[model samples]
Target: MFVEWMMGLAPGWVTAIPGLSRAAQLKALGNGVVSQQAAGAVRLLLERAHRT
Candidate 1:
């Protein structure tokens, strides 16, 4: 799913793990960071800071 990609995780990182329940998988994904999105947010903040 796109959420996995957002987390910068490889395919199957969430869904393919043996013994993981669906709810657990969802919780893990929910707790993950969207690395690229975070980077962009930080960059935007830095740019605005520099402009001030």
Candidate 2:
């Protein structure tokens, strides 16, 4: 569900979207997926964050 929402967002508007970074917003949208073992969606997001 969480992954679906994030994937639904426009790539160009991801960072522009409000309350979406630095306050663990992704972690929030991610629910427990952020902490689960082998959470691929969350891992990809963290990786993207690192690139920026």
Per-candidate TM-scores read 0.61, 0.28
Candidate 2: what lDDT?
A: 0.53
Q: Write the per-residue lDDT of candidate 2 for residues 1-52, one digit (tens) a residue.
A: 3453545543433345676674555554455332344567778989999999
The alpha-carbon root-mean-square deviation between model 2 and the true structure, to one decimal in Å, is 13.6
The list of candidate 2 runs beyond 4 A from truth reads 1-38
lDDT of each: 0.87, 0.53
In model 2, the Cα lDDT at residue 27 comes to 55
Top candidate by TM-score: 1
User: Model 2 shows how many backbone clashes?
Assistant: 0
Candidate 1 lDDT, tens digit per residue, 1-52? 6668778889888989899998898898998777788899999999999999
RMSD of 1: 2.5
